[model samples]
Target: MERIYLDNNATTIVDPVVKEAMDPFYCQMYGNPNSLHSFGTEVHPYMKIALDRLYSGINARDEDDILITSCATESNNTVIKGIYYSLIRTGRKSQVITTQVEHPCVANSCRFLESLGTDVVYLPVNEDGIVTPEILREYINPDKTALVSIMWANNETGLIFPIKELCKVTHENGALFHTDAVQAIGKIPVNVQETGVDFLSFSGHKFHARKGVGGLYVRKGTDLPTFMHGGEQMASRRAGTIDVPGFIGMGLAMELAVRNLEYEATEVRRLRDKLEDAILSLKDVLVVGRREIRTPNTILASIRGVEGEALIWDLNRSGVAASTGSACASESLESNPTFVAMCISDELAHTGIRLSLSRFTTEEEIDRSILVIRQSIERLRNISSR
Candidate 1:
């Protein structure tokens, strides 16, 4: 049986081209970038080239602005905790602001900070999972605000936030801004210079690269305490021996994504709408984030009278793969915080199923997925009614 994987938001299959680009590094080009030998020196250029590619992909001002890390979790922790520690030492600012719909890494980071007596504010989002600039402006206090961390795009609903405007508001209020762009990067254009974000975090696996590689963009002159302590890797901003092969794969994957961005936006979005429309035609199903500005490849639909996990299991048996919410929070039985924050009823939240696509997702798979979901929902609802 052929499987139709629709969980791109959780992670993506590594592109063949990216894998090819990384193959040599695993055996022939394996060398620690920090080493001074020929083996290391020869491998060093690849890392630099990867950094340059990432810089170009995001339109970052300088290559030095990028700090390589293991994943977006580390990047988020580094930015939020680093800023808090750095500012507390100087007795300048004490507040951090973020949204309730942010990924667990970011949301939990704020919670941890709050426990430590940091004034952390989790701004609420609209029903469409959006945090408007107006809402941000209201919470921002220049005198006490040190940083504002928000996500560029939501992983579940695929809703795109106004990062550029939010960054401007934060700066005007005398605070720095950070955006977790893990789901936004590659799928959309991200120009750090244009957005003026002080810090940005993104993971490679979200965009067809290896899982162990990720990057953080920090504006020049933005002072923050280092998250890791070790050798002079990532300009000493992050300390650890870099994953050479993973970085190579990420660079190639990002290069491909930028080159095909337009096609992904148009074609993928068309396919997503087709799937959504078909699914919505079924009775008693509501599309989450339907009216919001969303990314090209996600659809979160709540199927009434059916449990999300059970429906997903049925879909899996039918060769269709989907999700209930963030893979990071999949182990929990509670409703997703994103839906809860939107004030969605417990019944709807528990029935919400997320279907995310990728450039490789074909129209045939989408059609099959729609059919499978409709059948699964019908079967589950019938069973529930009985």
Candidate 2:
């Protein structure tokens, strides 16, 4: 049986070009960038090229601090906890704001802060699965709220938030803004200067770069306390030797993603719509958000009377890779959190499944997968009915 991959949102296969670019660093120029010896110094030029790619990919300025970290989880922890240590712990502020639909790292970090007496407000999303500026204003305590962390694109639903407008609101309220751009970076154009976000977190694996490498963008002169200790690496904002090979590949991947963003918006989106149309044509199935509001390559659909896990298993057996939701919590046996946040019906919430595509997802794969998906769903629905 031929296999088709439709789980790019959970993680993407590394691009072969990126792999080829990273291969030489392992044995050829294997050296710590911090070392002054020839081996280490030999990699500096390549490192500079990688850094330049990263900065240009996101439109970050020269003065901004792009600290390389282990993953988006670490980058997120650094931002949330850094704010606590920098402002909240200092007694200058006591509250933070985030949406109820944030990724686990951001959501759990806020919960941790709340345990320490910090007032954390989780703003609710509307039925459209979005936190409107009006809702933000209703809950924003301007005098006390120090930071507002929102994701640029939701991991489960792939809904794109109005980061530029939200950042403006947060700034007007005198609070710093942060966005988890893990899902948005490669699929959409991200300009930190235009959005005016104080901090942004991104992961490599989401965009065809190898896993275990990510970065945090800190605007110039932002006072974020160090999240790690014991080393002066990453300008002392983060400690530990960098993953040179991972970063190199990630930098190239980012550049490629940005360069081919138009293709993603066009071809990838067309295939996504074709897949969604097939799913929606079935009885009692609906997509989470309108296509206009979501990233180009994602589809979150709910099939009534069918269990999400059962559908996923059925699809897997048919040689199609799909997801019930975020891979971070895939094994938890829980309902779709995005549906829950959108106030979807309990019966339908448990039936949600996500199918995400990537630049490499070809038309032929989508065509073949559509037939398999339809067969899987029909079979599952029949069994559930019986």
Candidate 3:
């Protein structure tokens, strides 16, 4: 049986071109970027080139605005805690605002900050899993707000948030804005300059680059405290010896993504809509946030009376790979908080399954996946009824 992987939101397979771009850095150019030796000097220019590519990929104003990190988790932690700590010293703003549907990293970071006696507000989303600018204005106050961290696109429901407008609101209140764009970076156009976000976090593996590498876009002049403490790497913003091969792969991946973004958006959206239509044709099934503005490659559907884990297992046996929710929170038995925040019933939330596509996802895979999902949901429903 052929395997159909539809878990792009969890992670993506590394592109062969990106792998090839990383080959030289692994063995031939194995020199510490901070070293002064000629071998190291040769490696430095490649890092510069990678930074330049990333800058172009996001339309960043300057290369220095980007800080290389291990993953979006670290970046999220840095932004939330960094801003909180910086402001705590000056006794200025003490409130941090974020949506209820944030990823585990950002959500937990806020929880942790709250434990430290900081005011953290988790704004609720609408039934469509969105936080409108009007709702944001209610919580934002220039006198006491420090940071507003929201995600650009949700990983589970694929709902796209109004980051550009939200950032403007944040700035008007004299607060910095951060967006976890891990799922949105390659799937949508992300121009940092246009958005005016003070900080943005994105991971490599989400965009066909190698895992264990990601970036934090810190707007120039943002007073963000450093997260890591070691050698003066990442212009003293982040510390540690950089992963040369990973950065090279990420740069190549970003370059490829920017070049193929239009094609990717069209193709993935077509396949996703096809899958959604087929799944919705089945009885007693509902697509989460279907009418909302979402990413091009995600479909979160709920099949009544069927458990998501059971459906996923059945699909896996049939050579179809999918997910229940965010990969980071999959280990937990609890239902997806995003659905709960939307006030979806427990039965529907428990049955939610997410299928996220990629540029490499083929139409045939989507067709097969739809068939497999229909069969799995039917079989599971039959079993539950019995």
Encode model 1's per-residue lDDT on 201-231: one tens digit a residue. 9999999999998999898889878899998
State the C-alpha lDDT per candidate: 0.87, 0.90, 0.88
- lDDT value, residue 252 of candidate 1: 81
Query: What number of backbone clashes does candidate 3 have, counting pairs of residues 3 or more apart or in separate chains?
Result: 0
lDDT of 2 at 109: 97
Q: Say which prediction, candidate 1 or candidate 2, comes out ahead on lDDT.
A: 2
Per-residue alpha-carbon lDDT of model 3 for 192-308, expressed as tens digits? Answer: 989888899999999999999999998888899899989889878899999999998998899888887897678888888899999989888888885449998998888887888
Worst ten in a row by lDDT for model 3: 325-334
The ten-residue window of minimal lDDT in model 2 covers 325-334
Q: If scored against the real structure, what TM-score would every candidate get?
A: 0.96, 0.97, 0.96
lDDT of 1 at 371: 83
Against the true structure, whose lDDT is highest? 2
* Candidate 2 lDDT tens digits, 123-195: 9998788888888888887789999999999988899999999998999999999999999988989999999
Q: Is candidate 2 or candidate 3 better by TM-score?
A: 2
Evaluated against the true structure, the overall lDDT of model 3 is 0.88
